[model samples]
Target: MRIIGGKNALDASSVHPEAYPVVEKILQATTSTLAELMGNNSKIHSLNAKDFVDEQFGLPTVNDIFKEFRKTGA
Candidate 1:
């Protein structure tokens, strides 16, 4: 992964390719649930991204992810 920020501006890190599927699944599930909840609704003009993510995805933390990984022996 590449990260760009601050004075240093850029940095790269490595991640296992196997992790991609897990991340993709999380994103797909989040977006699908969000769409279902927002179906036929046009009044959401001021929803905060953070709040929306939290509400829709339950704001999963590192510990939660780790717990899931352990549960699945991943």
Candidate 2:
């Protein structure tokens, strides 16, 4: 579900070809990080979607995207 969302978002963004790998890496890392955080936590049933987004925002992919944007002025 998350991967599908990520891919859709990426597709909609029209990011540069060179940044595709970076974006994909970020998506994978974000998924794993969230999985690890949720691991074996039976008591945890609900989570704020914003919190997951906040975590992903801190990933290096954000910086990579910015750099790509700067390079291309896109």
Best of the candidates, lDDT: 2
Residue 15 alpha-carbon offset, candidate 2, angstroms: 1.9
Candidate 2 regions with alpha-carbon error over 4 angstroms = 1-11, 32-74
- TM values, all candidates: 0.26, 0.31
> For model 2, how does the per-residue alpha-carbon lDDT over 4-49 read when each residue is reduced to its tens digit?
3453344434454445565455446455332242222331223222
Writing each residue's lDDT as its tens digit, candidate 1 over 49-73 gives 3442342344343224323332311
Query: What residue pairs clash in candidate 1, if any at all?
Result: none
Top TM-score model: 2
Error of 2 at 26 (Å): 0.4
Give the distance in Å from residue 69's predicted Cα in candidate 2 to where it truly belongs.
12
Error of 2 at 9 (Å): 4.6
Off by over 4 Å in 1: 1-14, 32-74
Score residue 68 of candidate 1 by CA lDDT.
33
